[model samples]
Target: MIWNENIECASRDSMSQLQTERLIRTVKRVYHDVPYYRKKMQEVGLVPEDIRTLDDLVKLPFTTKTDLRDNYPFGTFAVPMSEIVRIHASSGTTGRPTVVGYTRNDIAMWAENVTRSLCMAGVTKNDLVQVAYGYGLFTGGLGLHYGTENLGASVIPISGGNTQKQIQLLQDFGSTVICCTPSYVLHIAEVLEEMKIDASSLKLRVGIFGAEPWSENMRRDIEKKLKIKAIDIYGLSEVMGPGVSCECTHQAGMHINEDHFIPEIINPETLLPVEPGEVGELVFSTITKEGIPLLRYRTRDLTRLIYDKCECGRTLVRMEKCKGRSDDMLIIRGVNVFPSQIESVLLEMSETEPHYLIFVEREGNLDTVKVQVEVQEQFFSDEIKELQNLTKKIKYKLESTLGISVTVQLVEPKTIERSAGKAKRVIDNRKI
Candidate 1:
């Protein structure tokens, strides 16, 4: 993987030209090294020579989550296991876990992407980073860790548990930066408030959060609560891990490391590339990776792509906050919806907490979605009718925002699960 630190600032025409060259190389590599990709390409009448330019990428076959699952273990690995240095995988909640292999160069490439993300977030060697994301097969912890290290910053690898110890380290070590999921950060803020800890007194300055979809409203809440700048980071286990792109200090949008990874927005139904600034499924192709290289891997995440230069002087392409996944999208009574939409609306209501669940079901040939909300006493009035009115208000707000009617069931505080880690927002029962 070539880590040209200046690629982000490279001219647009030059970046596209570089992408074309890398695409040609990646196409040849996948077609020659991986049998699965070769078969798929053959089915689509695609050959290495067929992909001569960036536009020719559409001629290649699109990869999917199912492809990774069908390949299982290392079936899709471009290199032998001996050459691979690291392994990461999806949670496989829907089916068998889709695993990814990384060679030394691949690992270096991933670290470089993460490092670039940190640089975009204004993290430097002088900052003390506290990584609160989970370790293990999950890539959040180590991804951010290696990136921070790559930037020559001091990292405290407090991998996601023991909130008190995490705080103590933040206070005692004077950690200046934090990384974790946005919901987990909010939970930590709550704990800090409970323990009467002064977050303003803490040395924390910025937080990079990802692994799940969030909204700008949520960002404002997190920044206000923690008294730190909250930036968004995005990645998936399929492509690499957390650090494919990140928000700049300007907070415009996440800048994709276009030199290493090629991003395309494609229509979900047709699997064809969409025009810039249009919403569609995100696809990625690893250019500088050596291990388990992917070509046109369809990341179900939905977002728009921007080609304008960022205020930070990086000319790399930018992507908006992921709206939802193509597969994760739900249709009820001709209404299209997403879990993140429900979560966003829930977070806005003063009567509610971040803890909630979306129950999707098929009742009598009709799709049903019930949003379970936790009501707080702060907004919960003494009169039962007033509390009922508050519930209606929440439902009306959600309906207006989501453009779909949802049954909002208000429950007692702490009745639903509370986590110092990632919050599970959906209890989907409609299994395909």
Candidate 2:
């Protein structure tokens, strides 16, 4: 069912007016309060007064992850420390982390967005949601946690990992909904299989999966293995976490909460807006955020937006499932490849399991890619000739799809390591 019918189903004329109003206020505030933003605005030769309409948003300088990293600490926050009630930083693997602070109102807005997302996935106040996303500095766990509470649903804040305990609670609590990265949910499914327990035994009816780009084939696998509707949710730590947009039960596309944050798509290479329905980098401008209101924040995610009204009766614009990230695209030798492309090919084959990883390395001035794929137990046999043929078959499929030859190593089921978070899809060892 639809949540916040007034806003979600609002007409384009009305939504644009609301966005323009918030954008004007946010731009004015950031220009006046945040020095970094003020300087960026100066560099663009535009002032807050120039941003009178949503069309003027193009005048604002784009914010990048580098900008956040360079600032570190509390450099980009618009509000004073006295007003900042909570702080969340990115779990960066290198360099200083991108820090984000939130006011009480910001937290409430976040909760409202997440609650709306849960409702989009058909979650009711009576549903028990088991949030398996990790907690702490990561936004996934607490983001979902606060939203579930706001929705008045019973939430089991059982964080990630602990396979045994996760299954134990699922059986005992009979939670109707689960939330976590798509890959982690697959890992849980594997554990359930090892324990000789069937998914039908649980009460889980829906799963909200995000944090990593997954294939449509993989969604089918999740649905079959978990016996639940695998709904795709979209968000990032920089944008506002997993509740930014979510797929309704119709499963057409994720509906963006345009009232709180406005969405835009731009050509990554040219840094210009792409035509409607054309894939490009996704950008967000947080108009309602007070603690750290970002103007024209580039998210680097590559996806197209849909404007047609959905069968679910929501007029909120929809974003197609992410094709891949412009930043995440791996350029091996001359051809660019995405992990999801390989995943789609593997999942479509019955003999191969869903678990796999890609290793990119440089040797003697040449780039090499090796794919480690898990073969189903029935397909993993000692017959060298049969295994060789199977490997060749998979290699041909991948080569045809990716337009690049890759070394395919077929291993027994459960050989590839399973992760409790976003699956480590690629390991690039090139010293570029």
Candidate 3:
């Protein structure tokens, strides 16, 4: 099942040695080519020589999204513009989009990483893959696109949106493997239900989902509805897209592609490395990237690392599914809560649908959190007492889990808008 046995199953000592060598070369390249990196290194009173072994990585300055923005379009690029073959960017909702460039070699490496990920997810050359992630500036679509092609699989290249057409293509093309965001896949499943389409008639067997955090409950719901193996894939546009890590058929933690990208877990508050198997901020250092090699880039995702060999026989380190993001944490009435916690609670309830939204608003001197969730059609009834009981049950569970009182409103099915991309899970209107 491993795509590259030599690298994927390499011993810890050998992998560490390879990472150290690549890390040294990356440091040298960035220190000499990128003035911003050189200045950052000089500010820390260090040079490329300071990073000899993997242990020395702690001495290097950490890269952040702000650093990428300050550099703008091309300042972060290590190679010359002539050598750069491709460019991709983030949505830039907060500010300027974080731009990423890829040289020809970088593109090939990216494809290899994703290809390895696809193989780990049980995809093969014989399976027809449908890529529903948005293409172009967004890295998800094309990242999976080229990887599927590189794996020698037939690719539909359907991109995102057009739900009806997507369903038709899924049935007609006989796509055995689907790649897209988890939420989008759920939306597609909803559409199939609306059309009264039998999931048994479809050829889908495996689904590779990523680009957003999803709960384990949601994964089970997806698998049950679609009748496909729901696999969690992790990646960020800033760190070479969706190929950074993926789950094998084992369905344990996602395996990090340590050969190309070095994975690290550090306490976000202290900015120090956490003990192995402890939850902390996930960081990555792109060692083999040619165009935009990054050193110790903070991903802001919260997860733990498992260095033990996997049951699937791969020796690569695995990262537990992300709990939430450090910046995405919401403090309601002086109590910190994550949307995933609420999601976990809702998904556990059979009466409620997976789609829900959290609305945080300031009411006078107090902040109120209101959760609007969809109730299954079969559960919807005209009895006021029954509705009140359902609401109370949801509110009690959420308060017990989140440790904060919340207003639970049970709406009808399909009340909340579904997305073909990352779902908007939270809307905070408090002007803090």
Tell me the tens digit of each residue's lDDT in model 1 across 370-404: 88887776777889999889879888987776655
Q: Write candidate 3's Cα lDDT for 1-432 as tens digits.
A: 689999999999999999999999999998998898999999999989999999999898899877887888889999889999999987332325679999999889989999999999999999999999888887889999999999999999999879899999989988999998776788889889989998989999999998877678879888999999999898887789998999999999999999989988999999999987899999999999988989999988999999899999999999999887777656553234667778777778774458889998866424689999887866577899998898999899988877668999887788788899978889988653
Give per-residue CA lDDT, model 2, range 11-32, as digits (tens). Answer: 9999999999999988888888
**Which pairs of residues collide in candidate 3?**
none
Question: Each model's number of backbone clashes?
Answer: 0, 0, 0
- By lDDT, the better pick of 2 and 3 is 3
Off by over 4 Å in 2: 329-432
Q: Please give the ranking of all candidate structures by lDDT, highest first, separated by commas.
A: 3, 2, 1
List clashing residue pairs in candidate 2: none
Q: Tell me how far candidate 2 lies from the true structure as C-alpha RMSD in angstroms.
A: 12.1
Residue-pair clash count for candidate 1: 0
